[model samples]
Target: MVSSRIVDYHEDLVEEPEVELPQMVFADGEEPVGVRVLTYQSSRAINTILNALNEAEIQYLRESSFGKLIEIAEKPAFSGRFARYLLSRQLKVEKKHEAWFRFAGNPIRFSLREFAIVTGLPCGEIPKKQKMKKKNINEKPYWPELFGSMEEMRVSQAVKMLRKKTVTDPDIRMKLACLAIVSSVLLSTNLKMKMLKEYAELLGDIEEFLSFPWGRIAFDMLMTSIKKRDEISLSQDTIALKGFALALQLVIVEAVPALTEVVQDACSSSESESDDDEIESPVSKARRKTLNPAHAREVDRKSEVNIIFN
Candidate 1:
């Protein structure tokens, strides 16, 4: 009976072992922190310790000041895990990633790449380097090659070339001269009186001269001659001539709207010309080529022309 009882007691002890509850240790003065009890098994006591450690870590993160938080983040003991958690919480709650970035001396020490690695978040792509375009030698005019021999050219030849380049079609020139005269009369009191006196001397009746279109044309032609004289005065390179050019430019500004209107009217009037009858001069063709493709097409369709007559 004693032998049977011993065997039965040994079997019962092997079947069930007594479990001891984990005790959390604290300092002599400090109170013990709370922990979640999962299983009664001693093997699961490690999980309780882990839970206490996690709580301690979270408490450190929460109670600490900004400087202390940075100190804790720099510690290798946490392996950046606490730093990432703190930053993630900050991003979620405050929607401010720049604070941490600013603290880290962003772009230099703590770049987007570092931020991405710490947070396990997607990073922004680096900007691609822009390739500089090579300038077209054929497109640009060589100023030296074109104007280098101008000093050696004859005065008459130079004058002829200048006139050819500066002056437009005869009709356009006349229109611009008319516009300039009208602008001068409106803008200058002295010019207006001079024009009135010239008209009175030539026609004997200034009102009749102004009423007639042909008289207006004659008056504009006379004013144009006066402007040409002023332009000739500019050849001396005097300070007064410079002031005169400035004054003339100011006067011309007043005429721009009228000039634009006259040109548009001329374009409208010439719109009915037959394609076969229209002669495309070299200057006009070059001008057309310089225009934007859409504008060029519009010009071709509308028979509209743009000329620099001034």
Candidate 2:
């Protein structure tokens, strides 16, 4: 289990003996915005509401799936510019498990191993799609309550519903927040995101949901998207990166601390958020009559994140 602070697994691998790498390769461009998860308020709620519950003698934060993640969010906003620059330098590779970036003339590999350390997320293998695609899913506690008649709900819409103050149960709220973070933040990309039914069903047991290897799924989503686009597509004026670009940014930082002063962070830069991710009033009827009602864009199969790993 990861403590409050993320360990430098990258540093452990590099060791205190190796000669330091050169300055990082730099690039200039308009950074594409990843999904704007409602972390600002959601994190607060976790501390104020979720942690205060009488669930156990131990603090809920210690036991939560996203305990370290919430702590990471509080540190600083995602560095979209830096992340984009790193992606631009990605080298072509045959393997899908890891991405190699040419940083300071040295190749730094960002794989599930590095991702787990930087993000403090479990990188366990996910169950096969065939097993997860069981029938009669609507009966699950989360399916009908969160979905009802809505066939396809966007990740943003699900975040909105979960962020509502009306959902008073702390345990329930914690589970929903996990879904929001996974669908909205970790796997965020240019294309509109839909809440996976399989993900929602897992919330039926918070323990099972926590036990799942979301980090592996997130890594696969990001690497697949990167693999999908080559240098040409990344250089195009219409570049939209898939997966959580920030993960790459953090990994880059860990790999080379010298570049920290060079790249511009999204928070300090006050980078304007993408219109699609701007936080909307959960109470807005135009968006959805209720969480039980309308939501998000249809999942584009072409760009849909393939996290159903064997």
Candidate 3:
């Protein structure tokens, strides 16, 4: 039988000393250039060489042994604009690639110069300066007396003053009247009715007031208040509703012509049954009887006011 032996590799584990590479030195007779070159095993170094080569050379390298080196190297993904910038710079191999590598991923923010560097595009130009016109310093403030001391005056006195202002300064009168109407509406139930009645009496001929834009504004306010009747507290809703109804009635009485035109337009548009196609159902007969001209005339004569109470 042949003798068999096994080798032990554990004995070969020895510590090696670190070796330092030699630095270039100038000879005594030769002048030192004072310049040094450094290299990195980084993607930027490979990119620098790749960027310089012709298309054929690049293709040949990519298919040869150098292809493995390119694959193993840490080449950064560059944006189209940033790649153009790198091409524009024409940087050398072994350069400090870290500065350019920092912009590899999406940048959080960038200065205009850095943006231009990466994008290879110019920054937006600054806008031209403009001259401003001076405003008039001596212009007097308008209607200073309208708000001042008016609250201290009695209701009668205020009304008289507003009436006087109405002819010469209608805007101020409208403002004051609108303010009074809003204040009266917001007061407690009893006070609200009292104040509104007083205002109605003070205005005297409601028709004359409704002729102005301010009267239309007051009319709108009254109608809006009526529509919001359900939103009022149950305790005050009755009195408030009555007041709004009365106010609206008074306005409508004054603006009857405009209201009549609207009513006629509405009635004309409603479907009417012709005698030829008329159906004689009990309900239809009753409705026709109620709407008959003779019966309507009798009712109109009895209630000269021509207004629906509701």
Candidate 4:
């Protein structure tokens, strides 16, 4: 059996021992020269070469006899601009690759310099180019095995969008909250396609309906939730309704803490402003004087006016 060990070999190749510090040399009368150390290893360093080449999806061929490796570079048939953009946005690799490969092989140069410039990876450290193989265009989307419960998918989709910073908009946030509540209710009641469709339709009647993108995200979240928990049956409709009610209650319940925080913040800000105004208020000083007056006559007169007004 062939055995292989992965290791870093570059740290082992230093040759010079430590030397004492050099005294300063006068450079006024001397010519200065600069030298750069360029290092390339032969094919004998197969493991090291393989590791370096394996840094990305790019491919390479090794020649042991010649002690050299040749990296094969090719331009993807499609425009890499959109692919690069999506990649920069950190989309899934499959999505990025699929988008790129959809563009057939047009004659384009695969520039490592451009790749480094685009991706911000070191120019010299770029890996070999791999063939961009197109996937089946008609492949049907199905639930993955990892999330066996469909409800998990639903909940998770909402979470994913929130993670993507989609819930920043108030409208989106509210819709997502509503969708979450609905999905939880549906899942709890063991509603499948028919009920799910009706729920979506009812959502349309809601004045501030979520956009298609957000709705899809909400749907995905519902599916995901079911997938995760591995439970989707509503053995008792009453219990399911209770679960649905609980889910809605949870979203509503969050608003209490949120509103409280907002109110507290507003109060604190108002108090701070009042404190700032107090520092320069002559009116406030005069008011304090009236409050602190020690004269019995003045106090009695003010009391008499209060009683007469009453």
Q: Which candidate number maximizes lDDT?
A: 2
lDDT of each: 0.22, 0.51, 0.25, 0.22
- Candidate 3 residues 146-191, lDDT tens each? 4453323322233334433332454445434433332222221322
Instruction: Give the better candidate number (1 or 4) by TM-score.
Output: 4
TM-score of every model? 0.14, 0.64, 0.21, 0.18
Q: After superposing candidate 3, which stretches have Cα over 4 Å from the reference?
A: 1-143, 146-154, 159-212, 231-237, 241-247, 251-310
Give the top-scoring candidate (TM-score): 2
lDDT of 4: 0.22
Q: What stretches of model 4 exceed 4 Å from their correct place?
A: 1-153, 167-169, 185-187, 190-197, 208-310
Give the residue spans of candidate 2 off by over 4 A.
Answer: 1-62, 136-141, 147-164, 189-194, 262-272, 277-310
Instruction: Estimate, for each residue in 168-252, the C-alpha lDDT of model 2 and write its tens digit.
Output: 6666666656665666566655445556666787877777787778888788877786678654556553345555655665665
Q: Where does candidate 3 have its weakest 10-residue lDDT segment?
A: 34-43
The model with the greater TM-score, 3 or 4, is 3
Question: Residue 111 in model 3: shift from native, Å?
Answer: 63
- Model 2, position 170, has a per-residue lDDT of 68
Ranking by TM-score: 2, 3, 4, 1
